[model samples]
Target: MAGTLTVWKFDSPTGADTAITTLEDLQKQELITVLDAAVVSWPADKKKPKTHQLNNVTGAGALGGTFWGLLFGILFFIPLIGAAVGAAVGALTGAMTDVGIDNDFIAQVKDKVTPGTSALFVLTTDATIDRVHEEFRGQSAELISTNLSHEQESQLREVFAD
Candidate 1:
């Protein structure tokens, strides 16, 4: 089956952290197959968010470490790379574009996930969308997933720069 990359935004700093448990439980029920996952938790007092890769949960299908690093780097570290990384930033941007993660999506993620907020990025396949969606109901979670098509995700693995 084709895979999907999904991002969920939460109002509270620990909301995404809490949701991880739910996701794991859902996976156990066979409602979804989680390939990999990560969380960005930005506490109220912190200047930036903390990005954590859920290494333990990832199975044989883990997307390499560099993929996650580059993604979070683009999302949170571009400012630091603005002048320093120079042309490399252009290359990274180009690579991300190849995967359908365009500037608009990046800007939207930046706009919504801020300090005192959190986000969960999950790579999965065979998801029961409505059932998974219902699990988070009555919560402040917003599905801010780039919602990349399976084709886009396939392109991502092929084109992502090391």
Candidate 2:
């Protein structure tokens, strides 16, 4: 099945958290199917960001770790050493590329989502954008990136731009 991966940035961690909850509600209502979701929150006092994934299945957990690890590595420009780390990175990169999410997008998200802020990364199927926008009306959030067509991305930007 085709899926869209999107990153929504918020000025405050609380806004991101609320948006995640809204996404959960949409999933429950069958408006969207959330395959995977993660939140990156950077607290003011913390030196590093905290990432939390929606699903905690063992297999999914390891994949999620690779995803976040690569992200953090890119974000901080950490050089990967050892064959195991290199191999894992290579594998994850290929997997993400196949899914239409490239390293560039991840880097962009890492750059934009800063300390005291948060971002929600969602992989979803059958999303009702209009209804989701309505649910988020009057809320503050930025559509950072998505594996969506130009027109669709524009529509989403306009929806949240207000």
Candidate 3:
């Protein structure tokens, strides 16, 4: 099966960063394939979160750029300094709907991952969920949302929407 878009939330940015590292390690071990990953770290001072997307550095090239560019475009309304890139990203965002990610999911992540917290957005396949869960033992991280199912998504929305 194709990978799913998943968001993992942590109480602290450090925790989220650690989780990303662990995910990378898993990928190295051939336990999972990380298509693309992004981390959002909200400063304690309540400034705009710093976002680091791995797609740019991982050779995802244009497709990766378009995905993250469109995402940040939606989250921050980043002025599409260039009309061509902006148009391409906009169209890509629409095309991504078939993959189970949409503006609503992005909006939810933006709204829920508040100041002083962090979130890791991952597109992955061949994940060993049980092993991953075991790896996260004792962590306060929560699986906030995913392209899993409607009932689960609704439950997550209810829990974090407040």
Among the numbered candidates, top TM-score falls to 1
- Give the per-residue lDDT digits (tens) of candidate 2, residues 6-91: 78888886677888778878878888777567778877676667777767311253235455555556554345354657776676
Model 2 bad stretches (over 4 Å): 56-65, 76-95, 148-162
Residue 9 in candidate 1, Cα distance off native in Å: 0.7
All candidates: CA RMSD (Å): 1.9, 8.4, 8.4
Better of 1 and 2 by TM-score: 1
TM-score-sorted candidate list, best first: 1, 2, 3
Model 2 worst lDDT window (10 residues): 56-65
lDDT per residue as tens, model 1, 106-126: 888889889999999988889
Best candidate, lDDT: 1
Model 1 lDDT-worst window of ten: 56-65
Estimated TM-score for each candidate: 0.90, 0.70, 0.70
Summing lDDT over every window of 10 consecutive residues in candidate 3, give the lowest-scoring window: 153-162
Local distance difference test, each candidate: 0.83, 0.66, 0.66
Measure candidate 2: CA RMSD. 8.4
